[model samples]
Target: MKILHTADWHLGQLFHEYDRTFEHQAFLNWLIETINSEEIEVLLVSGDVFDISNPSATSIKMLYTFLREATAQNSNLQIVITAGNHDSASRLEAPKPLLESSNIHIIGTIEKNSDGSINYEKLTIPLRNKLGEITIWCLAIPFLRMGDYPSVANASNPYSEGVTALYREAFEFAKTRMSDNQTIIAMGHMHTHHAEISDMDKTERLIMGGVECISATAFDSEMKYVALGHIHKAQRIGGKEHIRYSGSPLPMSFSERNYKHQVVIFELENEITSLKTLEIPVTIPLLRIPLKAEPLENVLVELQQLHDKNDFEQAPYLEIQVLLEEPEPALRYKIEEVLKYKNVRLARIQPYYPNKKESTSEFNQQELLHELQPVDVFTKSYQAKYSAEVPEHLMELFQQTLIDVNQTEA
Candidate 1:
């Protein structure tokens, strides 16, 4: 049986205020072709089907259309999807009854029985081949939340302990169902220890002192493959090749521009499993001018070197990093003039200054409350951020804006 592991589609994502519909559609098209060509038997989407819990109607339609197309193209293909942190469990699994009829299993959240016991049947799925013979048993566990797993009262690391306990229970159940010839595979949307997250990635929650992190030992060695999501960087966890994160199809942030976004493919035959990676081609490139922050003059010179490519989706997304001695009000005009005809979409302007003071974590409540007037509050904030007093003209503008606001309220 041939199985493909992919996660973090983040469908209907808006990249830097620019609609990424074209890019996402391109990826979907490519994925359909791959499924047809590879004749993949099972497709495992670990989690994060949509960008947000409440996705736009267009995103929902895209997902359904992909599912329809995938099934129509390859009738033998089986898809199993689970919900992630960014997903609304109930919403994602609303069409479960209908989807299952077409070989699609959607497990968004834990389902309980009459007595409120976890329904292991919903979590464990059997992957059968063309001959109607069970080849592998899959533990389709979704992102675990509070109360989802068995209660581990008074445990130091309750989250990790509960997660491990759940996996063990599922693994043991899979073992009971599987024969000697069959293997067990697990899917989890979790942050495992030693997994590499993209630099400056604010999308994924940081490792808060092992509070939300679990170890690779959570999985039993009997499992053949562990498909993980939540982290956008594709990597093997704990030096083990089988336990891996397939990574996001698209770069979640500019910092992930260099990520080799790919899906993992595994072929199992006669108890031998062979795995490989299929890299997804970048539909729209992300450009960071000069590859580092530079002075406005230097950045403008480099921006001018770019040739005009006006193709809508083909035009690369750009981020400009400028080093400034002081604030330049004409910064936008300068960049726009250079990139006006370049056809590159300017996404962000990262301004950096020299002799920056690092912010401290300590908070002085008394000092904070000492600013009685709105002007004093604004002045203190401006000075703290810019490391200098607010300019006279800017201060005048601020006062005028405040006066207008006050008048409107009156």
Candidate 2:
């Protein structure tokens, strides 16, 4: 059986203040072609199908349109998608009855039985071969929230212990329904302790509680392959080749402009699996000015030289980093005027100034009001309110909230 894994689509996402309908549509189109060409029998999307729990009508349309087109192009293909933290569980699974007939399975939340017990049967999905015989059983687990995992009394790390227990139980349950020759695989949307994060961007920040990162040992070693999500960089978990994150297909932020956005494809035969990655073609480019923070005078020259590559219909997104001796109030206006006729969208203007004598905690009210960023403000407020440095998960939540607000306001 051949399986393709991808995640973090963030459909209907806006880059800077600009709509990304074009880029997303282009990707969906390319994905359909890849499905047809690769002869893939199954597709697994780990999570974060939408940028927010409540998505725009246009964004919702794009997803359904892609699904209809994809299934039409490949009749034998089966797609399994799970909801991430950004998705409203019920909303993503609302169309389940209508979609299952077409070989599309959407697992949004953990379903419980009338007796208040976790329904393991619903969590386990059977992967069938071309001959309509079940050859693999996939434990399709979504982004687990509070109360979703089993309660372990007096556990030091409740969230981590709960998650580990849930998976252990799920895996054990699958063993009963599986044949001796059938393979067992799993899917998850989480942050493992051994994962590496590209700290360059705030777009992929994922945190649920004070302690959300779990041990990679959450999954039993007996599982053949584990497809993961929630991190944007494609990488293997620890040293395990079969455990991996396929990453986002588009750059989530300017810091990730150079990330080789891709999807993972692997073929499983006779309990052995082989992995390969296919890079997604960039529909629109993301460019940085001067490659480093520089004086405005130098950055201007680079922008002027980029006029030759300008395309009004499909202009590249640009992020300018300016090193300043003093505040340049007209910096934005100047760049706007320079790019008036050029084919580029000014996304961000990052300014770096010389270090001040006062530390971040020493900033006055006036300075805090005008000089600090939303993140800085969030840090100060969280410290004042909680009387401690902000937890990484809280900061991640604040960052994710800020991104959502910015996208909405834009």
Candidate 3:
């Protein structure tokens, strides 16, 4: 049985603020072509089908078109999909019944029967030939899905223990459902093992509950191969045997500039016969140039040092960190001109004093406090003294009184 393990599709994703629709379209085309050429039996999309919880209508259409084309091309091809935290399980599972009729199995969340047994949850996709049957047990462990298990709500100690226990129960149930002679191939979207993380991913995780790191040993015993998603980088976990993460199809962030997007292909003869990684070509070139400048002249000199000087005129997306004693409007103007390298985007302006090491974690706490403009010293003193819950309207009145007192004091 030949299966193509790909995950973290992140459809409708944006690279920086740039629309990735065109690049996504190109990638979809490439994926379809590869499927056709490879004569793949199963296309396993581990998770993160959509980049956002609520995707645009156009994004939905793109997915529909891709599915239609794929199903039409290969009557035998089976597509299995699950939802990552980025996607709403309900939204992703909307067309589940309809899609299943077309040989596509969508497991947005774990489904358990009253008997506590995995039913249709373990997709026993058959690879039939004259020799016998080789079945792949498609196990979908959705991201942030707590409905399947009862033990994971606001638990004491590390939440991972609860998560691990839930999966163990689920995996134990899934194992019983799979055909004994057939090989089991499990799929999920989550973090596993220690690995290098991208800057953009790090930023996004901050807003989302970044508490996710599962040991690979959880699935090591039951399944022959485990295909994971979530993490953007393609990696081998659990001692690099059959467990692996097929990274996102494209670079979703500038921090992933160094990562080459790819998918994993496995040839199975009971156990995985052969496995190979395929790289997806970038539809558009992504160039990130960090220019540090204390003065306008220094900025220009650094810009000249870039390999493609014309890239400035191209308005390439950029992150500029400036360390200056005094950054003037004039300097900003000259920097903009030099940045006229085509499509040059000023991502960030990080100003620092000369001979001072910048503390990346520290922020201007005093400025934030002053911006609040506490009314009078008495009002501030009152706030500090009180710990009682105030009503919304009362809070508003208090804020206004404080502002007035602050103005009066000024």
Each model's Cα RMSD: 2.4, 9.0, 8.0
For model 3, state the Cα shift of residue 181 in Å.
Answer: 2.8
Winner by lDDT between candidate 2 and candidate 1: 1
Q: Give one digit per residue, the lDDT tens place, for model 2 in 1-410.
A: 99999998999788997899899989989888999899989999999999999999999999999999888988888899999988899999999989867889999999888987788888899998899999888999999998888899999888889999999999999999988679888999988876766763233465654388878888998898899988888889978888899998888788678788999999986565678999999988998887889999998877887775445557889999988765566999998878887778889998875443334453444574777798888787655443456767767988899999999999
Query: What is the TM-score of each predicted model, taking all chains together?
Result: 0.93, 0.86, 0.77
The whole-model C-alpha lDDT of candidate 3 against the native structure comes to 0.69
- For all candidates in order, the CA lDDT equals 0.87, 0.85, 0.69
lDDT of 1 by residue, 57-168 (tens): 9999999999999998888899999999888999999998787578899999898889987888889999999998998889999999988998777988988999999999
The TM-score that candidate 2 achieves is: 0.86
Indicate which candidate wins on lDDT: 1
Winning model by TM-score: 1
Q: Which residue window of length 10 is worst by lDDT in model 2?
A: 355-364
Quick one: ranking by lDDT, best first? 1, 2, 3
Off by over 4 Å in 2: 200-204, 208-210, 308-310, 356-410
What CA RMSD would candidate 1 show? 2.4
